[model samples]
Target: AAAGWPLSELFDRQFASWLDLDPALDATNRVPSILNGGLGKISPVYWGACLGAAAAIDLYGLRKKRSDPDYFPGKLGFDPLGLYPSTTTGKRRMELAEIKNGRLAMIAITGFAFQEFVQQYAVVDQTPLLFKPVSDVVETYGSIGGYGM
Candidate 1:
């Protein structure tokens, strides 16, 4: 969910603007590299907040545990539907699902890397379904040969 949220946000016009990405201007065979430009300027604020959030969560967990000796620190018992089973088989299923989700997220990140390496454009621009048809995109930006490769 974490990786997917950022990926989706990159395609969102307003969110991408907030992240200092201008789809219209960024549509070119420009290599992705270390932080620079407007993104570089705002990156510290975004990452700093993420670090602060993590610290806050840790402090809250510690305070809760200290206040209640029997308190479970990690799990919040968040299953509203009570679907989480206590059985061993159910636990294994949950674990497998988590593993699959993580692997899928990794694959998605890898795909983004390769797409940038070849397409050399914003993911939103490279995606045909976003701004144009597949045929149009392939014509305008050839598959695997988009950046004169």
Candidate 2:
């Protein structure tokens, strides 16, 4: 929940605007205030509420997971969709797949953050292939000149 607002804003074409928010990019100490500033533009009370919700979820999940020995983190009490397999091997495979996918997503997000930091450009604008079927963008913008090649 804490990441939802920033992720939404970034995906909604506010990626460039983030440069205006933290140009130097060294103000790690003021993350809360920065988050509040951006969130305040949409809703004055969103920041605190989101923080509270994140804290509550963290606390509740930790407590609940600790209390239940057999309760898997992703398992629903009742799988109405029957997506989960009954076999232990199938369950372990699903867990491993979930972890791997989560790790892949985290890596992608980290790469996006680094790209934004160094390039100071929106990933969508840089990644033309995502929005259209164009090869010229990669040809024109993929040069290594900016890295002093």
Candidate 3:
């Protein structure tokens, strides 16, 4: 599939896609601190909270499924060891997971955005030099900056 493809054209298109990779690239450039800023603020407490929320949603879904009438006989609506299998045809054991976890994903995403926003303007950016080149960090700010390459 590499036949007759002009290097320049391919390069241009690829470059465009690269720009899309970090729409916030421009923003990161504008605000070096925030973009490069360390998110160490994502403390253990914050991690515990995210993990707790995700776990709570998982547990709630497990309980709901237990009473869902779809659970296998003699199995508390779980696959094994009181744990729900993420995938199964028997009554869609994880349907609740999709619903509950989907909501958690949304809430968590929103929370992350809010945290970044506040950190960008109000908090001091403490980005580590070693981490500045990380793809995720670059993407986070690049998308915000509308990085068009």
Residue-wise lDDT of candidate 2 within 1-149, one digit each (tens)? 23542344334334436645433222221122232232233344655798999888777767778888887676435578878878999989988998888887777766656654555444444545554345655565577432211
Best by lDDT: 1
Candidate 3, residue 94: how far the Cα is off, in Å: 1.2
Off by over 4 Å in 2: 1-44, 76-80, 133-149
User: Could you tell which candidate, 1 or 3, scores higher by TM-score?
Assistant: 1
Clashes of 1: 0
Worst 10 residues of 3 by lDDT: 1-10
lDDT of 1 at 24: 24
For model 2, name the residue pairs that clash: none
TM-score of each: 0.54, 0.55, 0.29
Tens digits of per-residue lDDT for model 1, 54-132: 9988888888888877566454446799776789799678767778888888787667656665655555555555645
As for TM-score, the candidate ahead, 2 or 3, is 2
Ranking by TM-score: 2, 1, 3
**Residue clash pairs of candidate 1:** none
Give all candidates' CA lDDT scores.
Answer: 0.58, 0.53, 0.45
